[model samples]
Target: MSSKKGGKSKFLSEDLNELLNESQFLKDSVSNKKITKRQKNDVTEEESLAKLIGQYQANSKKKKLDVNVEACKESRQKILDVMNNQLETRKEKSNNLLKNLSEVMVQLEVDCNAMKDNEKKLEHLTGAVVKCMQQATTAHRQKLKVLKDIHASFKKQCEEMEMDHKTETDKLAEELEDDIKKLQEKLISETKRSGWENLRRTIFHAMQNDF
Candidate 1:
């Protein structure tokens, strides 16, 4: 989430920088326009003064007019005053623009610093994420190893149990065979006793008499 916010802030910063550049461009254009207007005003005033001088020369040649001389002087003084005032106004305006431009430059520097800081922060976050991922991978690997060991142990236990069962079954079978052998021996001995021999002879004599 922090990473996403950082990305958005970066985008907004870039946009703001672009807007600042456009604003500077517009300000420069406006400053140029003002200078051009000032120049045009000066040229128009000069042309008017030149025409007035020509008219005064023509009138002086045609007749001696005192009132026209005073008017011409006053007109020249007024033109000078207007020119000086306009020059001062232009100079003041240029100074103000320069001051503003300087301030804009400072702001741009600050924004650049801010962008650098944000980039550093992002790099830090990326490194942290990488570290976390590595740790998780390591943990998972360890868990898998543990599980594998457990499985191997279980398999070994199962084999041991089966071997024990086979051993017990073999022991029981041996004991049963021994018991059957002992009983068979006793039966054979009883069948071959002295009483059984006497009975066999009696049965044979009886059979001869009947014949």
Candidate 2:
């Protein structure tokens, strides 16, 4: 930003300089034009004055001649005074314009410096913001990692619990199967004893009937 302001100041300076040059050129042109016109007027007036003096001298040899010589001198002096006044006014106006331009240039320079300072401050603020964002991102990543670790641990625990439950269920199933087998063997033995007792009773009753 400072660089950009510097470039802008440079551009403004060039434009101001160009304006100054153009103003100087215009002033010079006006001066030259007025001087040339005054010189032409002076030449014409001198010729008229010479012709009038020749007429007066020729008429004086015959009689008294009345000539407003003082009036002519006064007119010339007034013309000179007016021209000088105009020149001085023009010079003063040009000086004023130059002064105004100089003030504007100085103000622009001051504004450019102020802008450079503000830009530097903005740069610092931007850096701080970027740093804060980076810190927040780092913290977020750390939290995400922690959550992942906790999830992994929880999953591992769940898997271990499921395995233990399966092991206990299998043990219970085996014990139930052993109990069922023992009950079945006891039922078969009771049936054989009852059938044998019935057979012995029948043999004894047949022997008594034959006697």
TM-score of each: 0.32, 0.33
How do the residues 1-211 of candidate 2 rate in per-residue lDDT, one tens digit apiece? 5697567556656755665576456546655768765666545754765575556545552332123333444555665566557656655665575566556555655655565556555555778765665565556556555655655565566567556655755565566456545544544443333333333343234223422
Clash number for model 2? 0
| lDDT of the candidates, in the order given | 0.54, 0.53
Q: Score residue 191 of candidate 2 by CA lDDT.
A: 37
Off by over 4 Å in 2: 1-125, 197-211
Which pairs clash inside model 2?
none
Error of 2 at 38 (Å): 99
**Clashing residue pairs in candidate 1 (N, C-alpha, C atoms within 3 angstroms):** none
